[model samples]
Target: MDDIVKQALAKWPNVPHCTGWLLLDRRGNWRMRDEAAQAAGAPGEPIRHTALLGFINRNYEADDAGQWFFQNGPQRVYVELGYTPFVVRLAANDPSGQLTLTDQADAAFEPSAVYLDDEGGILFTNRSTPARVAVLHDHDLDLFSEHADLASDGRGGEFRWRDGAVLKLEPVRKSEVEKRFAFVASPAAYAATNPDNASR
Candidate 1:
């Protein structure tokens, strides 16, 4: 949390929490949902301001209940996830020739679990830290192919690291990702009945 945001919270402790107004899309774009867009079930217009995007990314966090939000000064703007809470991209290092995963928030994490969907979607998450999972953007499939050591998993292909690192990964169902990945990609569905169990 930023010091300025903390001070704002202290000064205005009763600010109302906003929901269904912000979205993080699959391509790592921050979108602002207007009233019309919310009613139409859309991700709304892309927020293109560089400073605002940076502020939101810097203050992005999750509550104890698994609800991800951006602490915008004093008010908490809950995010509506378009895919996963994070969207990660793969990049190859020039010196080491090693691949790394950087999330929508621009933080790199070691991928511990990798799953490939029938639609050729690449899912990855670190079993350590926060356990936030991400789907590689469709545009980056080529980049992902460059790093993945793919093998036949009987159904679809599975990924293996370059150094013969073998990790366990099952064919996970997209609908059952909440149980399999432990993070909520869609939050609005559970907002009325069980806000806290958004991911569950």
Candidate 2:
């Protein structure tokens, strides 16, 4: 076991009842098995397994989740939890820890790279721009009332639940014709090409 994992184990002797836990590398590669095993206690025979990523993705379910990606020198450790948002307990070696919570109110949107509030609300950026933010009006019963359901399509694609509705997010890429002339010419180049143009 690594020093960080050991430290986490020591601090949280009894891991909270969560759907799944994932350990990933800096390159987003799965490092450990994705399973919610008993923390050396609590249930029947321990399910000894490997490939943590596969286990969690296959077995458990999650709605509001959090992930902590730690970097120290060459070692990169990523800890992710599915189902319930983890209660962050700061340790001595912890440089930075991140937590994210997504529920029924915010299921249709994508998360931004911003610090979350103490109550798990998404924080806003100082620089104003056209962006979407999902605010939880009723924190107590929002998630329970607007639970998302997971459904598998006849094909390999999976459907995600949003706002008490099943929404399919099929990956679609722009065509090559649509992607042409996408790069904007530099101002200097444009001026050189059109010297007489007044809009310099």
Candidate 3:
């Protein structure tokens, strides 16, 4: 959390949280959804301001309920996820040739486990207390395929990292990702069903 955001929370505690206004797309873009867009069920405009993006990334966090949000000074702006909470991509200029992964926030991610979804989506999970999951960027799939030894059934595989670490890839169904990872895909929809979790 940012110091300014912490001060704002201390100064004005209980500022109601807002949802259905921001989104994190599968491609790692932050989008701002307006009332019109929300009503039409459309993905909002992509947020391109560099400084604003940094601020949001700095304060992004998840609640005990597994709903991710950006601490916008005083109010919490919950993010609607298009996929997993984090979208990772291969880090640039990694001299070691090891396929380093960095989350959308541009932070280093060390996977404790990896999975291949039914649709060929690659998922990585870190060893954090609650565990954080990320989806590899689609553009990097070809590069990853070159390093993986997949099974005949395409259900399991072994990935050889440039650093000489071999990881066993497990199979997972796309529809079970949310429950398996303990994350809410749509916070607004979740709050609607669990009225007690909603902020008025």
Give me the candidate number with maximum lDDT: 3
- What shift in Å separates residue 154 of candidate 1 from its native position after superposition? 5.1
The regions of model 1 sitting more than 4 angstroms off are 149-158, 162-169, 195-200
Model 1, 1-55: lDDT tens digits are 8899999999998887878889999798999999999999987999989889889
**CA shift at 165, candidate 1, in angstroms?**
3.3
Q: What's the CA error at residue 42 for candidate 1, in Å? A: 1.7
Show where candidate 2 strays beyond 4 Å. 1-68, 80-200
Instruction: List pairs with backbone clashes in candidate 3.
Output: none
Using TM-score as the measure, the top candidate is 3
> 1-200, model 2: which lDDT tens digit per residue?
34555576566655432212333221223333333332432222222354443333233221111123332222223333221121111111234322223332123233332222333332211122333222222332243223322224322232223233333322222222112212111222333465564121
* lDDT, candidate 2, at 33: 38
lDDT of 1 at 114: 82
Question: What C-alpha lDDT, on a 0 to 100 scale, does residue 158 get in candidate 1?
Answer: 46
Cα lDDT of model 3 by residue, 70-178, tens digit = 9999999999999999999964355756578899988998888889999989999988988999999999898888788999999999887656788899999999999
RMSD values for the candidates in order, in angstroms, are: 3.0, 20.2, 1.3
Sorted by TM-score (best first), the order is 3, 1, 2
Q: Predict model 1's lDDT versus the native.
A: 0.77
Candidate 1 clash figure, as a count = 0
TM-score of each: 0.86, 0.17, 0.96
